[model samples]
Structure formats: structure tokens, C-alpha cells
Target: MNKIIEIVSSLDTNQVYAELSHPNSGGICVFFGAVREFTNNEQVTGLEFETYEAMALKEMNKLADTALEKWGLNKVVIKHAIGKKEVQEPVVVVGASSAHRSACFEACRFLIDTLKETIPIWKKEIFKNKSVWVSAHP
Candidate 1:
């Protein structure tokens, strides 16, 4: 299965892992990005995420294609949460499965790093006394 993009208010790791699991897949790698409680020393109350949906999906699909081309992986799953999210909530999850552990790990890392840099997503950090909008990328 190749899930290019999924936008959900929440994600389930078990569901993602089950979807990627296969008899032919010898290894699976997963990466999760979560909302932190603080930013630049300010306490965060929550976050509101927004995106250029069409472009974001396009970039995500491209990421999946690149991973498959580079790693010859069997499957990839990318899930992202949109809308209000509280501290500790998962913001995104990437899963990759392959015949070997090396490819799975590499592809998972590549997918996440590329998505953070390339995806057109923005985050508004709601602090205790103020809020600020910033790029989703690191």
C-alpha cells in the first residue's frame, strides 16, 4: 500500500503499523512528530495548523515517489493532523516498509525531513499570553 497523504484530526500508530505490515516486508520504520509544550522558552497552550492543501498533497505524493525510487520499498504511509492540537498530540507520522531494515530506516527519515522542509504548512503557537505564526519546518 502507498498512502500518499492523509489529513486527520488524529492518527493511530497501531492502524498505521498494521496497514504497512506484510508477509513480504521484513522491516518497518516509523517516525512521529508531536506538539511540544514549549517554544523558545514560552509555554504553549496549543497549536493551530494550516496548509495549502492542494500543494501540500502534491509535495507529499512526490516524497512517496522519491522514496520508492530511491529505496525500492514495498510501502509507505504518511499521515498528518490538521486543525487545533494540544501539547503532546502527534502532528505527523511516516511509516515505511521494505525487505531490509536499512532501506526502511533511511526512507522513513528522508520522508520526514523532506516533508518538513518542503510541505506548505504553517503553525500558530498559542502561548499563555500571546500567539505567533511560524513556518512548520525546523
Candidate 2:
């Protein structure tokens, strides 16, 4: 079975790992995208992520389904956090399981790459002296 998708204020790596664990799954690929302290040397302080939740969720699920079909994977889980996030905090996590390592890795990478390009989300960057809005997937 597929795992849940949560949009929360925070995420725990261990908890996410445990949720994706499966007895028949021989390989698991995990990806964590954290809030960076600097973007183009702008000295970022924090970021606020906003999404059209319904549309974003639909796209994310479509990404997972495509990956599963292409890779013949056992399961896939994608979780993203919204709202204000501090530097170094995880913003997104993706996990994929398969019977082999190659498929797992490929699917995981595809999931994240596609998500960053296709998801409809926006991020407001708060810098030390200025702030700006940018494409979340960019």
C-alpha cells in the first residue's frame, strides 16, 4: 500500500522512514529537500510556502502514479510541509520502494525532479534585508 502525504509545519526523518518501511521491499530511496540558508548569496532568513493544496496534491499523486508505472515499484510516499520554515529544516521528503536498487533510485529521483517542475506552489523568501516571492518548484 502507498503511504500518506502530509502537509505539516515540521517533519521527522525517522518517522517518515518508518512509515515507508515494508517487509517485502528490498530497496528504498529517500530524498530530503531542506530550506537553505543562502540563495544566490541573499542570506535567507526563512521561507513561507503556500500552495493550492488540492491542485498540488493532485499533481503529486500523478507523479507518484507515473513513477510506479514506469518503474514497477512497490510503493511510493511523498510528503511536503507548508507554512513558515526555518533554514535547514526539511521542506520535502520522498520515499520509494522496489525489489531492486536501480528502480528505487530512478523512481525517487524522478519523483523529486518532476515535483519541482510541475507542482503549483509558491515560496516567499525572507532575506536579511529584503523579501521576494519566487516559484517554489524553481
Candidate 3:
């Protein structure tokens, strides 16, 4: 019954996973998104993430509520990093738990996909000499 909607400097994957564990849930799905070294075949050094923290968290919570209601999910946790992130560093973590595996998988997928599309977060692709502001929604 707990909803995890947070924006932090770093994402704690283990902690989010722990929060998703529930006796009523038989299946759990987790997703981790890391800063990649390449984008559209362009070499990348790192990434910088920024957000309207209050608005973003509110939107994230709404998504969690939607998932819970639609999928009968027992737990939904979404953690996003707001700051500079190096390559391979986790930027976002989403965990969903449901009584059935199908619901778990669908809810987890929906959480990540909907997050990227609807969240009010912005990102910058950091290159060797320049950085460009990018849209969080892909």
C-alpha cells in the first residue's frame, strides 16, 4: 500500500527492491536505467538530469496510482536521479509487485514507459566539450 515517488541525487536499487517485496505479491518486476556512453551513435561522456522536483514527484505518484489500480499491484516504487550521472550509473529504478506475473510485468513496463513519456524531467547529454539539453520524454 506504499507508493514510492522520489527524485534523488542517486538511486538506491536495493532499497527500492526491498520496498517492493510484499507477502501478497507473488511476482516482482524491476527496471534500472543507466546513463549510456552513446546516443544515436554519438559518443557521450555523461549525463545531467534536472527536474521540476515537486511536479515530477506528483506526476510519478499519479502513475503509481494508475498502475496499482489497473493491475492490482501490491507495491510500486519509482526512483529517479537528479544530477550528474556517469556512464553505467543507474539513473532510474522502477519496481512493481503484483499477485500475478502478468500483472507484474505489465505494470513494470507501463511504469517505465509512461514515466519517460509524461514526467516533467529534463536531461542534458554531456559530451567531451559540450553539453546539450535534452528532452526527458523520448
- lDDT of prediction 2: 0.85
Sequence-dependent TM-score of model 1: 0.92
Which ranges in model 1 have alpha carbons more than 4 Å from their true place?
A: 136-138
TM-score of each: 0.92, 0.91, 0.94
Q: How many residue-pair clashes does candidate 2 contain?
A: 0
Q: Over the stretch 82-129, how does candidate 3's per-residue lDDT look in tens digits?
A: 999999999999889988899999999999999999998988999988
Q: List the residue pairs that clash in candidate 3.
A: none
Which sections of candidate 2 miss by over 4 Å? 136-138
lDDT of 3: 0.90
Report the Cα lDDT for residue 138, model 1. 75
Distance from true position, residue 127, model 1, in Å? 0.4
RMSD of each: 2.0, 2.0, 1.8
Q: Judged by TM-score, which candidate is best?
A: 3
Give me the overall lDDT of model 1.
Answer: 0.87
> lDDT of each model, Cα atoms only?
0.87, 0.85, 0.90
Weakest 10 consecutive residues, lDDT, candidate 3? 129-138
Model 2 residue 58 distance off true place after TM-score fit, in angstroms: 1.2
